[model samples]
Target: MARPKLQDVAARAGVSVTTVSRVLNNRGYLSDELRARVNAAIAELGYRPDGIARSLIGRKSGLVGVIVPSVADPFFGELVAAIENTLADRGYKALLCDCQENAEREGEYLELLQANRVDGIITSTHNRGVSGYERAELPIVAVDRRIAPGVPMVRGDNRAGGLLATRHLLARGSRAPIMITATDHAGNDRATAYREVLESEGLTPRVHAYGYATPIDERRAMVETWLSGRRRLRPARRLPPRRGGAAG
Candidate 1:
């Protein structure tokens, strides 16, 4: 069956199309009796307004785009969930896009979001330059990664956290603490903090940087090699025996 329209509701309500439109939009003052009649007619006809038509008329899509590296990652999954909940509270819908750590795919998703007339975008991936983002002409919030100069960003204090972690290890009698991380990461603030804390304590900081995009086997081999080298430099020390027995 054909769905009911505004004209059908107007005819059923015994009112002009203008009156029906005004009632639907709540534009002008309306008599209680007239409003009741229009609402009753709409209810009787089971009429539902077309969201796309309304969005086109209002020039707002009521959509917010969210682009992440990959939803498979727990961090990105949690981030997307938070964004979705916030958007839902604000009466906006989320258009989620996973770039899968591909720069070209990320750029394409950005264009797709733009073409869809999304009101804004929240991105956690910034592999490409700023030009792609600039062309979107929409409000953007960068997550963890800095984009263009004008773009706003939200990130944790990684450097402070790193410093705290290193200090804690040092206090616990960790003579040679090392940091392992991706080599091509956009920022090295954490590594800098780790180095600074180690240098302040008159200890050399050891860092092992690996390619994040490499195959799992290759990464495992690299890590194993680094660990073997470290073991050769400083063998594991035997702990003192406990009062009751040897410590497990």
Candidate 2:
């Protein structure tokens, strides 16, 4: 079946195409009765405005691009979902790009978002080797990771968060508490906070570092290797070995 258009709604409402366009765009003040008639006609015809046409007229695509390292990750998945819902509430569409932590794919997605004329971008990608941000014309917000100098960054305070956990262990008399961190530069703040807190308490902090990109099996083995030597430590400060990662 042929799709209904603006003319069909105008014909059913007994109005001109210009009036129907105004009603759809909410351009100038419209009487209740006129609006009701137009709305009723739209409902009956099931008419939807052409997005491309509206964008061409207003010079606004009403689309926001969202790029993430991996939507499969729980943290990033929830982040993307929240962003999508917020944009939807504001009557903007989201163009999601999952780069899978690949620099090449991220760069391509950035170009594609610009090609689609997205109004703005929210990204968590590290953009390693990805260029063009220095010359990007549109607004870009980085989440949790620093992408560029001028781009605004939104992230949690690593010091405050580290204190929460480290303080908890200290209160529990976990004198043997140790810090495990990833090799990535993003984890430097947390590691620094951990070391400072331990040193201030006059406790020697034992820090074990590992690669974040290490295979899951190798990571497990590395953690196990560290825990194997825990018996030599004291009991009152014995903190149980827990599986966790700080690479995100």
Q: Would you estimate the TM-scores of all the predictions?
A: 0.70, 0.71
Q: Who wins the lDDT comparison?
A: 1
Tell me the TM-score of model 1.
0.70
How well does candidate 2 score on lDDT at residue 110?
A: 90
What clash pairs does model 2 have? none
Tens-place lDDT per residue, model 2, 1-248, is 78999999999999989999999889988899999999999999899999878877887899999998767655677998899999999999889998877789889989998877788999987546688776788899988777778899999997677777887898987876777664335446766767666666666667786543445577678878787776567643323333342212
Would you give me the overall lDDT of model 2?
Answer: 0.78
CA lDDT of each prediction against the hidden true structure: 0.80, 0.78
Root-mean-square deviation (CA) per prediction: 8.5, 6.8
Shift of residue 88 alpha carbon in model 2, Å: 3.6
Poorly placed runs, candidate 1 (over 4 Å): 1-4, 12-14, 19-26, 30-48, 176-188, 195-248
